[model samples]
Target: MYRNLQLLRSIRYSYSPPKASVLLDVSNCIQGLKQKLQELNELKVATARKIADYDPMPKLEVKMQEEGFVIKVLSQRSCQGLLVFILEAFEELGLDVLQARVSCADSFTLEALGNKISIS
Candidate 1:
C-alpha cells in the first residue's frame, strides 16, 4: 500500500508543469527575435523589388532631319530649372530653335526642332 502511494505521488509530480528556467527563457526570446528578423528581411526584399522595377530615368530621342534636328525629352519626374539648364546647353551648342513645345504641369516634356546657327 505504501509503494502504491509513492507511485501515485510520483505520477502527480510528473503531471505537473515543469519549472521555468533562465536558459529556456533566453532560448524563447532568441527564437522570437529570429522570427521578427525574418519578417523584416522579407519586407526589405519586397521593397527592394518594387524599387528595382521602377525606372525614373528620363527618355530622350533625337532625330536628324534634312534641315535640322528634332529633339524630344520626356520624364516622369520634374526638377527645378531643368528647362533653363537644357536651354543653356542649347545655347552653348549654338543651336537656333526653330520650333518648340514645352509642358511642365505634372511631368516634364520638351519637343524642339533646331538647327546649328550660321556664324558670319
Candidate 2:
C-alpha cells in the first residue's frame, strides 16, 4: 500500500546522517590537539638546546659572611647564560638563592652577582 511505502521512506531518511555541528566539534578537537602537540615539540627543542649549552665547570669565588656567602664569577658569555649558570651552581651547593643582581656595560662587558641564603 501507499501508506506502507511512505513509512519505509521516512525510516530510511531518519538514519540519513549526523548533524554538521557534531562534525565541527570533532574538527575543533583535532585542531586543538595539533596545537598542543606543536607547543610541546617547541618546548622539547628549547630544553635540549639549553642542556647542550650548559657548562658544568665555571669558576666560582665564595666569600664567607656572617649568615651565608656571596658568589662571584667572570666569564665572557651573555648575562642570561651567566645567570642560568649561577642558579644551577646554587642548586649544586644545596643552598637557596635569596636575591640576584646583574650589572653590565654596553661596551661588551657582563657581570653577574648573586646572594645566597642557607636554609639551615
**lDDT of all predictions, in order shown?**
0.81, 0.59
Pull out the clashing pairs in model 1. none
| Model 2, span 76-119: residue lDDT tens | 34454656665686788677666556554421232333445447
TM-score of 2: 0.36
Off by over 4 Å in 1: 1-53
Specify the poorest-scoring 10-residue window by lDDT in model 2: 104-113
lDDT of 1 by residue, 1-120 (tens): 545444544644433233333334445767999999999999999999988876688899999999999999998778789899989999999998899999998789999999999999
Which candidate ranks first by lDDT, i.e. highest?
1
Error of 1 at 43 (Å): 11
The superposed Cα distance between candidate 1 and the true structure at residue 92, in angstroms, equals 0.1
Number of backbone collisions per candidate = 0, 0
lDDT of 1 at 72: 93
**Positional deviation of 37 in candidate 2, in angstroms?**
0.3
